[model samples]
Target: MVLLVPIIGGVVALGLLVWCCVCRRKRSSDDEPTRPPDTSSLDTAAKSLGFLETLLTDDRVLIRRRFDIRDIQFERPLSKGAFGEVWLCTDRQNTMLAVKKLLQHKNDAYKEIKDFIAEIQLTASLDHPHIIRFLGVAWTSMDNLCMALEYLPTGDLLAFLRQNADMLTWVKDKLPMALGVAHALEYLHNRPTPIIHRDVKAKNVLLTEQLQTKLIDFGISRDRTQETMTAGVGTPYWSAPEVLEGNRYTEKSDIYSFGVLLSEIDSAATPYKDVRSPETGEPLRVWQIVSMIVGGSLRPTFSDACPQRIARVAKACLDGDPNVRPSANEVIEMLLGRAVSDQNW
Candidate 1:
């Protein structure tokens, strides 16, 4: 009856082996936070899976495989969004680059690593003084897709506006931001191949040490030259009439967006306000904002300090007819106090 000792011993040994493997896996997961194995990086894993190659054919892999992400010094996360989390990162050369870590889930077969890689590529190609410089990229076998970008420590325009709302102080901060951002838009719009920053919100505009405004977060941005579209999207409040009609977009679309951004920056008011239902408190999306602007329901809500000239500048940008909108250069001239009014003629 008690002769089953050998069988029981084998079962116990098998259980111990399973337990050891589980413990080893747990240890491996923990080790990655400190010094992850090279093979576990998204770059390596993507190569191994071949999913990145297949999926990145569109725009995600346009400029990948350029710069190397040899080493990284991870810092606290600066912001989080639907696309990913942006972290302050220092590259191998000790250059500070903002790293965007995608939360696209582990084992996602879509191969967005190329897009992750492409962001750096697209960024590096632009050399405008007003735009944020594209530094480099970090690709490995890790679950993360780290994009190393020039770090702008002064934070975004939204923060700048929130902290300096009073008119006495607003003028000091507002003028530079408006002028700088106008220059950025002018640069993007005037490019041989134009680009539309589809998500042109206050949060996306970062300020530098010199107080110059730099555009950031092009996740939803469409390089108008690269990807021409009859219909696409952008933030609601800033969306123009042509965009709302689902018509083709061009540099003028960006102008329309700038108009809304100008309104938001000058007035310091949230987009699509006073329209939320009291029951749910949920707000509308970009499409809804576009609808409102299209229906003539949206207005700039100009402040007392917002000069009529600025009003006209904003209106020119927000004009329902994209054909009638002013160029970024024109906006810049107006903002810089060099605008020649039509009345002068």
Candidate 2:
């Protein structure tokens, strides 16, 4: 009976061991499908540099679609900035587009990532003819973030002015181009949430093959409903006096830049090109120009070549006081009201 009890206890022990093994196997099997994603292949540098997760804003949430990296064929690099590289790319249908690949930095990737996302969000929300179109953004498995944008073949207005000086010298052509820019600003300023284009300059204005003008580069643009912006963050030569004084930027600041663009179109001369430093007779540096502007000493000299009416409008736009500067709509009205025959000096 003692030997029988011992054998029976051994059998029960073996059975319990078998049952525990079976239960463990079943549990593991169930968990196999629900296991966390395997990111084992990504090394430390690649995990930090390449990994990106998309977070859409309320504006882009419903409209913008995420694209796959496999669909983009990056052909050539068009431009490069501190945060990313803008490449000329083609899609599946062979359509040309500009794609910006945003890279992560070791120390400041978080804010850059946020800004890049914000740029895509704001750009995607806009659907105006004169505003550059935002196609889509992509987050690849390898952690690269890309934003596809509309390609303007003719390049920016700065280059266009350089190439087509003859076309711009005439008020007939110049007025229309100026009007197009005004209309674009009017659309932006009148939106439900007004967008202040903090960095408005000739380089930010792009021309289409059809000679259509479109405003691009909303990287520094801000919606007015947010906190007030008080940074000096624009092309120094095109900055308003108030901006140079470190005052908060308003829509009037854009008008100040437009005034410089007006002089650019009229004489094909860059703003403050003739302003020489008293100490060295060399052209004034950007800082000096800003000092002169803020000190209420320097103003863009409208060449005798510029018509009186156009010069008058430019002068109005360059008013030192922000309150005195004409709204974009008012500037458009004044330009449209003037006839080509009325462009007399």
Candidate 3:
């Protein structure tokens, strides 16, 4: 037994010596200047350990840009609205853009300023063919927020309708424009959290060189899921009766406004512009027309040129009962069905 112990100890020590020599030789081989470490194997091990994902999981691709005010040069003021003034601006790259600048200086301008910023942010996230595209936002040295939006060379729908009244003859121009606006509304209302465009008027609809209609001006828009219904937030002329009455308005209010816009497009004039006052027998003032709308008596008069089907769709939209009013998607179906029926005949 004692002799076997000595032999076993000698074998164990010899095995230890061989292992140490092998490890030393491996270290010396690793230190060779000409031999590069197996980085491909190391990368495979790293991926197996999720090291790459751990480093890149937090590295997100930024989709929005922050522009410096100095990069933009204002050319001229295009138009002024309740929220801000839009200008024709030129960027550092000599790119022409339309910039909306909020000029609220009053003490009570916080909400208005917030809405302006919100519109910029909201518009930035939307990407639809019929919805206006947002470029980026600029913070002026004077601490004012401005939005750079896509420039529509053909002006707004109101101006286009007035200047080109001959184009609204039939299915070629006017119906397509109406359908485009309807599709934009559908896009907004069909979002997971529906967006109600508080202001939907001809003046807020821009036209491109190809006469493509695009919806714009989301200063007073509300998300159905997140926002509380507020009344009296839209333009009085194009606003729905319920909105004028300071009632809790819904997406149906936009349909009512779109009805008015249809009338504007058909007549090539502003709503109530030609309507005579019942009592005075003269052209009614804007306030008087608003009163009539709230009274549920006066509505936009359809011109003789307006097709009966289009008029019917508009009438349905202008229904006093919001519950009976058709949704934007329904409006498109009505218009398209009418078009198909007419063609079939």
Models 1 onward score TM values of 0.72, 0.79, 0.76
Instruction: Please give the range of 10 consecutive residues that has the lowest summed lDDT in model 1.
Output: 1-10
Which is the better candidate, 1 or 2, if ranked by TM-score?
2
How far is 24's C-alpha from truth in model 3 (Å)?
88
Give per-residue CA lDDT, model 1, range 192-310, as digits (tens): 77777766778788888887888877665557755334443455456566655555568888888788787778767665565542346565444443445565545555666776767
RMSD of 3: 28.7
* RMSD (Å) per prediction: 18.3, 24.3, 28.7
lDDT-superior candidate, 1 or 2: 2
Kindly provide the TM-score of model 1 when superposed on the true structure, using C-alpha atoms: 0.72
lDDT value for model 3: 0.72
Per-candidate Cα lDDT values, in order, are 0.63, 0.70, 0.72
Q: Using lDDT as the measure, which candidate wins?
A: 3
Mark the regions of model 2 whose C-alpha exceeds 4 Å error after superposition. 1-54, 57-64, 141-143, 278-280, 338-345
Q: Give candidate 1 misplaced runs (Cα > 4 Å).
A: 1-70, 91-95, 106-111, 141-143, 167-171, 226-232, 275-290, 341-345
Question: Highest TM-score, which number?
Answer: 2
Flag the better candidate by lDDT, 1 or 3. Answer: 3
Candidate 1's displacement at residue 170, Å, is 6.1
User: In candidate 2, what are the lDDT values of residues 1-345, reduced to their tens digit?
Assistant: 000111222332332233344435533442244233445444743543333342453344523477877898999998887777889999999999999877656544545665676787788788888889888877644237678999988998878888888656546666677777888888888888888887777778888887778888887788876553554456666878777665667888988888878877776667776766455667655554555566556677666766777778888888888888888777787677643332211
